[model samples]
Target chain A: MAEVNNVVEALKFMALGMGVVFLFLYILVVLVKVQAALIAKYFPENTPKIPTTPVGNTVEDENRRVAAIIAAVSEFRKNKS
Target chain B: MKLKQIFISLLFAMIALTSMSQATGQDATAPVVAEVSTEKKAYEPKTIAELATSFWQTTGINAIFDVNDGETTSEPKGHAYEREMTWFESSLGRIMMILIVFLLFYLAIAKNFEPLLLIPIAFGGLLANIPLAGMGGEHGMLGIIYNMGIANEFFPLLIFMGVGAMTDFGPLLANPKTALLGGAAQFGIFGSLVGAVMIGFDLQSASAISIIGGADGPTSIFIANRLAPDMLGAIAVAAYSYMALVPVIQPPIMRALTSKAERVIVMKTTRQVHRLEKLIFPIVVLVLSILVLPESTPLIGAFAFGNFAKESGVVDRLSDTMQNALINIVTIFLGLGVGSKLAADKFLVLETMGIMIIGLIAFSAGTAAGVIMAKIMNRFSKEPINPLIGAAGVSAVPMSARVVSKVGSEEKPGNVLLMHAMGPNVAGVIGSAVAAGVLLSIFK
Candidate 1:
């Protein structure tokens, strides 16, 4: 009788435990979504916008930089034993 | 006058030495021992041979050979602790425990298995088995450590604070639905509890033992110390060992549960969380927990405080200290404190075997549940959720999260589920704490 009671009680405990966890986290999930929406509405971030378009000289400068890196690598490789 | 003064000083010093020598006899003045004949029924050893014999009595080697602790009849003797003579309390048992400690050392050092904790715990076990050392006895060094933080449940709570301070809830907040996986994983705890109960352990011991499935060490220790302190040693060892072996234990189970197609599914990257949202999260969690279950406050409160401190940005110093210095210091004591419980009489029992076997069952069940939960979520949701990430819901923290990512990558090269998995991993921490709270409220 006691062993049966033990199993039954354990099942009840398991249900309560699993139920509470799911309830708590599920609420948090909804709350999180709500919190996200509310924050988006009120406390919007001041994101500094970057200029997407490259300047005219950047392409030529990039070429020069790549050439300099190549020259430096060749020089270092040539110096190596 | 100078010679008279010097003679007087010498006479005073001689008198003091004679009295001191009578008590300790280290000074070896034979006349004092003879003069105090009536007082000295227990004569101090005078000869070198006698001294050696007395010294041997105090040594570990002699303690091993002594039958004073009543090894036979399973008789309760000498503070109700003794070697079983056949099992772990025997001299052979002590040596075996030492060798086991050596294996722990090898695992920690060579195999890189949770070295920060295992090293201290292994060392404490070493100190414990050293006969006559009494390292695990009342007022002994390890005993003091055990009583100081572990016994009162301070160390695990403080560790929770450190874990909280370091936790980033951004991923969890980004994809909140994954929290269900965390909750589902806790089935491991409940499932194991039932198994333990069925196997003749009482409710409290079963509850404490089952908590190891949560795969959160501090939470396991907190619950075990509270519910079933007698089983603390075995439960803790099982908790830590399985946690360290997360990679080894979790992967095969994960593979068995999920199809290759499910493993290869890619998850959406998490959205950026606002600083305000981050700051409010811990507060919301704390308030909700306090309202619902006051029992979980010790674990959750510390965790919430840690997360709040980190999010506040104003309390960087406090947060940094909690994360680094405070946590490091607590880890050392906590490791030793847990290790103090690894005394042979406590650890090498039938219950330890029971705890280990059931602990594995709990852990496997949790992993399978998490994966299955993820599959269920996929059926209901528009976005494809990789079932592999569900296995991380046991909250071994970054370890289980990393395992998910590794497993996912195995299915599809360059696949990343780490951030996605973190959602459930973090939730598992909360989920386990909630389960712990429920258990405490009922069984405590």
Candidate 2:
């Protein structure tokens, strides 16, 4: 009976220890969730959606026209000279 | 004779032309200069008026002036009630300190220095420090919240329930032996307890002191609330500051104790844990703990209830609620309540500094104890467990686990100890609570 009591006492001590540890753990997870929720609620989503696929030739074509204009101006200037 | 006559005529024509040109030039220039000067002078008053208007619009100080007449008329009624802050004497110092605390909280939250609690805590600190806001003063919102929750010890427990819901026992269950490492890590708590008593703190104060070793904030608050409610402010600040500094605290102790070879020691990956095993684990652990320590029931019971909610699978909605909405609501109140404790008179003291120092000591001791225990376990065990995982035995959770992984990888490239260390890391949470329960029962 004494041995059984000692075992019971030991068990009780273990349980107490486990309980305190778990309690802290429980609070921590709750705190994290709270933070995450706050972030999700307040942070605005404003990312611009860009369609994928290259648009390359248009810029080159514009650049060629500008170059042509510049060349024509220079040619006209030379002819005047 | 003809050349002389032409020269004389040319000189007269030149003189006339020069006089006429001068008169016309002066007439044209004077009007242009006069017009420019007139336009510039006109703009000066308009710009000044615009500046005044913008100043009024931007600051809205005019609104205060507009209401000033009414406020003056009603002033006599609120004169005694409107407790004036000692703004002239303490404003500068208070504002600077508040800014520093705000930055610390921001770093802790925004940069992920324990983001779980720090962000709310930082917000609370900011709210409290606003001059004459009355949030930390008599009849203030924060003051009321603090009295209702922290001083009364309600918020900490509610937070614990949320924590329990979010935590998974799978890692700890798969490796039950790691629980012993968790137990060993708690030496810091007892060591700090002894240190606190030696430093002239009473038993209750010492219990609050020891809890800092766990590197767990809510547990510290829980113990401090019961043990030394007066010291709650100091104990909490110390507990949280140390928790944020865990990455810095654990690595040195780990390096000092273990060799490069030992640090690099890698254990095999954990086996897939069965769901049935996971479900039963919390029950068995809780039952064993409850039977052993009735005093621990509050902490243990709440934790078990949360885990039960998780594992039962039927109460998914309830678990989700606890982990999400319920916890978030409690956190705002808890943070505000806790921040209310940082009143100028209560928080700025010699005792607060002592708590901070003792907190660091407790954390260092906890890390050392964990490493030593793992070394001892390594001697007896055939499984060849890496001692680095032992450092995670402090209840800092993923931070402690990440530290172990970082240090382990530093020793050997591609060595991943994070998942393995998580076993002990999670167990450390359970271990710290058990230790807290023991102290509560013994001291209560």
Candidate 3:
């Protein structure tokens, strides 16, 4: 019976409580979003690029791997013959 | 003259002999002294029947046996059977509770449902129910542990510290709008509040119980301890059980609220958060929380302090200790203390059933609110937000986030929503704590 009497008050609390939480979070979101945008604008992210070797050196490594594979295959054919 | 002297000596000798004879006659008859004796009583062993009766009486099995008195004893008046025993010592409810404890154990072990917490709580429930064990009494070990931590709100706050230490705010920083999803989920708390009050629970108890919707166990325990200590056990259990069941409970509501295409929507990768943003995040939140709701300081302060310590990078040892040793120890004692409240007299009631029903409603309502809030957000934004990620806004942490990922993957195999889901997941933690503060502002 007492709870029935207080239902109106509890509903009010529910509205107010949910409203406050939403308001607080909305403010927090705006603050964080603004801060993030500002930070990104002022300090653009800088990722260091990996150093590339000369094209001749890069080709030399790949050619060596290819040569090793070819030589293993030829040796196998000779042994079979 | 010689004859007269001999006659006198003979007469004197005769007189001496007679005197000696009379003295010997008097000494011959000695007086008698009476002797006192003590007799031992005979021992009589009790009959076998009598011994059995005594055993049953001593062991408190008489309540079950309907033995009111000794052999010739009749049942107590106003009852068909024995009625003198306390409900605590003997009741059918105790058996029902034992079965419930076993169910919890099965859920913890077989179902892999929050095993770290459920296992201890189930064992504690088992300990609390054993007849004559007094484990849940004021002087019992459980009672001491409860007083040491749970009663004073120490263990839950420490757990918040651990949670703060482990949490990374980078995802939330990358997508700040998801905080609204967190806020929307708090609808569960308020919705359950109305339900409880309508169901006849007092405002204080309803507030304590409704916080279960927030999906944060520590905050629930904290509020329950403050406003409704009597219902703390049921509230804590309901809060954790629903949290464990989040994977099962949230998906249907989430699916019902969102379209399949929305589930398949892939979110943009979160922006790379900078160190300065990470350091300032906890401080800003802490300051705002304290300024708005000082009653929330104990919880929010400990959480922010822990986050600051972790983000500072200068206190590796302290952060490690809070995240590991300190939290684990607190968890064990806290689980046991909560389980102590499962005594039949305390938990086997109409109110417990109400809390269980209301708590489920709270979780479902929160999940729906978050998903729906996301769909509404999509209406105004150019970027399509996967409404599935909003379901993670109930603060069940990685579990809720994983559920989001699972649902999304089921819709589209290559979709990865786990990191994106974490934005609202962590925000839900903050939102729930804030809701707790709002409730505290009223009830405290």
Candidate 4:
């Protein structure tokens, strides 16, 4: 009878302890999920903004560069003469 | 003629008075002088031979030999074995303990079994049993260290702080359900508590001894110091020993609990945890711990504080200090402090035997419980949870996690479970702390 009582007592404590741990962990799970959801909804990940125009050399840019170089060279020759 | 006669008379009178005064003084000193002379005659000065005998006694050589300073300085009847019989009487137990400490040294050095702790503990044990060394007694160095660290729970908490700084809780955060495995594994603690109580230990002692199942050495030391200080050495040894043996102990039980299919069930890789989530996790745990079990706040709070420091990105220096310098310093002292308790008289007791047996049971039960719980969880869950990862819930940290991975990889060569096992591995840490808190609350 005494041994049985000790076992019963142990079981009671075990149940309460395990229950409390489960309850606390379950709450943690819920809060973590909610936090993830809320953060995902309100503060989405920031994607880097990409420019639409081509970054490589284009025909217009090449023509402008040639024009500027020719005008500077002719001006320099006129000043020298 | 008159002057000469007066002078002669005065001289005669002076000589008589001097003589009378001398006689009176001698009468007063006679008794005292006689007593002094009698005492002096009674005490004879020791000769060179007698002096040698006294020196041998001081050097403890008298234990094996007897010396005499008689007329011829003859040898006494005392033989090597007969003189210090008491000293040699229990040489067997002491020698055995010394051998045991040497074995501990071998385990630590060759096998690399928790060397950080075992080395100092083994050395301390060696120093403790030296005949007449008094290292484990009051006023001794080891004794002072024990009083400072282990006796008051200072060293263990500091170690916890360091452990917290080193731990990355992102794994547990990534998969919250694995936290239940940590909780489930604590069954080993409570179950063993019952076993201990049934074995005739008191409730408090049973609680302390059973916590060895939790597989956290500092927590074991902390709880033992609080509830059953007398059993601290045994419980600590058992806890760390089992933790070191996790690779050996957990696998067999883990293999038995789950089938090969369950073992190879591939768990999805956990999502990346945000820095914000990592920062908030410790604070939330600290607050919730206080609310649930205030008794556990010291341990949980220190651990959480360490984790927050590490994750906050502002105190990198402090975090580094906690992880390396501070933790290393505390570990040395904590190891020595625990070793001080391994005195022959204190450690070689009936309770020590019970603690060893119960400790193994607690660890095995914990591993079994964790794996069994994972199997049950898999029954309802859509995601197939690998049962091997569940054994990591015994809280041996990365060691248990590694074991889980190794065992799983054995079944399916490409199936790696290390990352998945880490989830329950970290959870087991928190779960053990919570379980310790529960025990402390009930006992307190």
Number of the top TM-score candidate: 1
**Residue B299 alpha-carbon offset, candidate 2, angstroms:** 1.3
Candidate 2 residues lying further than 4 Å off, grouped into runs, are: A1-81, B1-93, B109-111
Task: Give the per-residue lDDT of model 4 (tens digit) for B20-104.
Answer: 4554676775432111122335566855433443343333222222222110100111122122223332344456667888999
TM-score of 3: 0.79
Better of 1 and 2 by TM-score: 1
The most accurate candidate by lDDT is 1
Query: Which one wins by DockQ: 2 or 4?
Result: 4
Q: Can you give the lDDT of residue B158 in candidate 2?
A: 76
- The interface root-mean-square deviation of each model, in the order shown, is 8.6, 19.3, 10.7, 14.7
lDDT (0-100) at residue B225 of candidate 4?
89
Error of 4 at B2 (Å): 99
For model 3, residues B266-328, the per-residue Cα lDDT tens digits are 666555577778888998889888778888888888899888888898998998888888988
lDDT of 2 at B131: 43
Ranking by DockQ: 1, 3, 4, 2
| Model 3 chain B worst lDDT run, 10 consecutive residues | B70-79
Q: List candidate 4 stretches off by more than 4 Å.
A: A1-4, A46-81, B1-90
All candidates: TM-score: 0.83, 0.67, 0.79, 0.78
Worst 10 residues of 2 chain B by lDDT: B68-77
lDDT of each: 0.81, 0.66, 0.79, 0.76
